[model samples]
Target: MGQAFLPGIRYDKMGEALFCHGEHVEEPSQIRPALERAFKSAEEGKPAVVNVMVDPTLTNLGAISMAYAVLFGHVPYRDLTKYGKAMRRSFLGFAFPGFEKYGIPDAPWPDGWEPIPPEMWER
Candidate 1:
């Protein structure tokens, strides 16, 4: 129920075996490129981190789910209602006994936001 703050540590100083290319993706548009960079680094036998930053306001299940859909190219849903249906399915799939009563909101992507291309998932 409480949050803790830890001072940041430099990744490069962790040791050679753990050296990694750290990429911070702050928006949906940057995700694919960041992932590609990480993959290329990994392919070259280097570690990488593609840290996709979700909005701080998205603190609930439904909101975070919608963010994932949009950030990961699952969106461009046929209609708004479909998003609610998807949320309902997701909620039912993961809801536990005491958490079953939480409502699933019709969360939608922001206006003018674009989906990551399907090819991003490939390779």
Candidate 2:
């Protein structure tokens, strides 16, 4: 979770593959938004990194497009939401039993923040 994959570099820290720009993603669909996002943050002078604790299968990719949100001023969040919905449906159809089936870990809600289960994740 502490490791960050910046745009335009490649590194590995603590079993996580950190990828930057110019690196090819095996699953472009998953990491594309984050790639774009990290670059946008750099361009907009907000240069930042998104620290995520996600499944090792995601590698450089995480659950949401946090990087892309920074890049396009978050205009893509709406689309990302839709994309997530569709993906959930696909997962349900395949009976993936949610991300827990993937052995993915979820971050605990911080003291000041609460976790709200998305309506769609429900049966």
Candidate 3:
């Protein structure tokens, strides 16, 4: 809930390794540095988890919500610009067309993916 991350072998592997541990929380300052390291390490291979307590929440829209992620790729008519525009208009495409069909503004992610800091949206 404190950070968003794209999935990678390191994190994915961590997820698989921790299939048994319940849950984990990460301390702050370490997050950005950890993510940055993971980004670079992935170029070579998966990053290593030096600790046993942490559990990676690997987020892969393509994998977690494949059907919904594919919805964008399937839009045969819309050009790139329009699609990007529509997606940003809401918090990560919340309430945007097609996403509603994926079940937004509803049960899960209760805020409907509304941007965390609304100020970032002005640009």
Q: lDDT of all predictions, in order shown?
A: 0.46, 0.38, 0.38
* Candidates ranked, most accurate by lDDT first: 1, 3, 2
- Tens digit of lDDT per residue, candidate 1, span 25-69? 658998889789888988998888655555432334434353444
User: Cα RMSD for candidate 3?
Assistant: 12.6
What would the per-residue lDDT of candidate 3 be over residues 1-123, giving only the tens digit for each residue? 212232332543565485521122257656666565555655666443432233333322332242443455544323323322333333345435765674533323323233333322222
Tell me, by lDDT, which candidate is best: 1
Model 1: lowest-lDDT 10 consecutive positions: 1-10
lDDT of 2: 0.38
Q: Name the TM-score of candidate 3.
A: 0.23
**Residue pairs in collision within model 1:** none
- Report the CA-based lDDT of candidate 3 relative to the real structure: 0.38
lDDT of 3 at 108: 33
TM-score of every candidate relative to the true structure: 0.36, 0.21, 0.23
Residue 105 in model 2: lDDT: 39
